[model samples]
Target: MAQNIIHLVNVSKNYNGTEALRNINLYIRKNEFLTLLGPSGCGKTTTLRIIGGFEAPDGGEVLFNGVNITSVPPYKRRVNTVFQKYALFPHLNVFENIAFGLKIKKMDKKLIAEKVHNILGLVNLSGFEQREIDSLSGGQQQRVAIARALVNEPEVLLLDEPLGALDLKLRQEMQIELKNMQQRLGITFVYVTHDQEEALSMSDTIVVMKEGSIQQIGSPIDIYNEPKNSFVADFIGESNIVSGIMLRDYLVKFAETTFECVDHGFKENEPVDVVIRPEDIQVVPAAESKLQGEVSAVTFKGVHYEMIVQNNSTRWKIQSTAMAPVGAKVGLQILPEAIHIMKKVTVK
Candidate 1:
């Protein structure tokens, strides 16, 4: 088992009386890629700031290697942050920017050169050492920011939406590059982002957050497949969520239909929320299946067709390779495993 390298114990923070984090308890394993994911004001960034020593929590402890370091300053911690804004010095060349920290420590001049060269190579900018910061593209500049942080050889790296400024294609490319870099370096990465796809693709563990609290923490697969509630299901991907009742073990009733699902442990006849992914639903001929709907809207989504099916008051979004014309009656087939059942939440 991997040992934890960082822990946030009952951490709470507030910004001018508005709670930013409430009793957040988290454990980050050494050398793992963990992402704190949520929408704006959900405390993901605040949590990252706390870990990076940028902000101290109103209450609780921040531990590094099981040692409390809540009050430690950012510069004293063995971690560096890469923000959305690269913050590269406009007048400095790539080498100078990356070597700034090493020079501050007054390391051997030759050793600083060696570290800068090595980090530049790692970030695929080996030949751009003398290039002025302003001459580099956005992606290259972001890489320089990362290279600067890595050149410090910190044990952990904190990233706050580092890819947020890039174009769609560049952002997608950097997502893969960042994951590869983390794996190659064998260090802990604590990332903060609101992009669900980015979190799912790059993180080993994903912590879902909501207003001032952590909602769930699990592997990307677990978080996507077995969401704890409707919010996670809706946020992580395209889901058809509706009110349901657990009729009995392995049985659920929703949309006036009783179906067999692989969910249990709920009280008999208990209310629940059923989450069905758009990709899990198969579009079939209406005559062959029991549940039917009219395809009210259809759009080609490159890999598949996204069809909005209307069955009276409920609208379901489904993705399938087979195209069903709008206004045509179609059937939806949801397998037992795809029918994830989550406990319902009460609205405020």
Candidate 2:
């Protein structure tokens, strides 16, 4: 059984009357890469800070390995954090920066040296020990910051947008590297980021938060394919959310057309939101399409093509393998598996 390394029970945080997190109950499994994903102003970072002991919750308790550590100070917790800015000391070299933590714990010089060397190698910075901090590229400096955090052997490592500063290519590379390191070390990683692709690519469990509330918690595939709500479906990937009426258990009506879907459990004539991912759409010859539309615009995105199709005044974004020229009559076909119907939430 996977151990629950960290548990938050009825956790709520408030700042001057503004609710930052509302009754958050979460259990982080041992060695699992849990990602708290959302856009800006979401409670992802707030929750991470609370878990790291950087911020205290106004209510509830935090348990680490079944031991209550709600009131524990930052230094007392077995957690390390990597911020967006590489917080390395400008005056210290790479080696001394990593050794600073171990030295404070009063570890012997020989042990510190050995540990630092191993970590440097692990982070692929074996020969840059004596190099100046400012001499490294953005990616290298970021790796050093990660090395500093991991060197302490913390049970949980909290990373808040660690790769946010790197370029696109570097970010992709680091994502794989970080996952590999996490698996090899068997340390739980709690990552906070607004990038949906990052969360989907690396996380074992993704907790989608919004406006101080938990929206959904599920695996990458589940969040991408079967979003719990309209916000989740739209936020996790490129989804076209259309208003639909449930006509039957496996059927919904959209855009004056009744279509078959896989979603069940809905009353007849219930208002719902149908989510169809762009990649799930198939474009056929106009005469062969179930839904006919004219291609409004087309843009080549290197590997695949992106096209905008228009039916009346309603527009739909389609990504397909077969490149369709602009002004062409195209038939848009969405498979039954691609249709995800969610009950519309009525706002007061």
Q: What tens digits encode model 1's per-residue C-alpha lDDT throughout 1-348?
A: 999999999999988989999999999999999999998989988898899998999999999999999999999898899975778999999999999999999999999999888888877788898999989998889889988988887899999888887789878877887898899889799998899999999999999999989899999999999899999999998899999899999999888888899999999999999999999988888887777899999999999999999996679999989999999998878788889988887775
Residue 321 displacement (Å), model 1: 1.1
The TM-score, computed over Cα atoms with residue i paired to residue i, of candidate 2 is: 0.96
lDDT of 2 at 186: 96
Which stretches in model 2 have alpha-carbon errors above 4 Å? Answer: none
List, residue by residue over 70-157, the lDDT tens digit for candidate 2. Answer: 9899999999999767789989999999999999999999999999999998878998889999899988898899999999999899
> Model 2 scores what on Cα lDDT?
0.91
Q: How close is candidate 1 to the true structure, as a TM-score?
A: 0.95
Candidate 1 C-alpha RMSD relative to the actual structure = 1.5
Whole-model Cα lDDT per candidate? 0.91, 0.91
Steric clash count of candidate 2 = 0
Superposing all C-alpha atoms, what RMSD in Å does each candidate have to the true structure? 1.5, 1.4
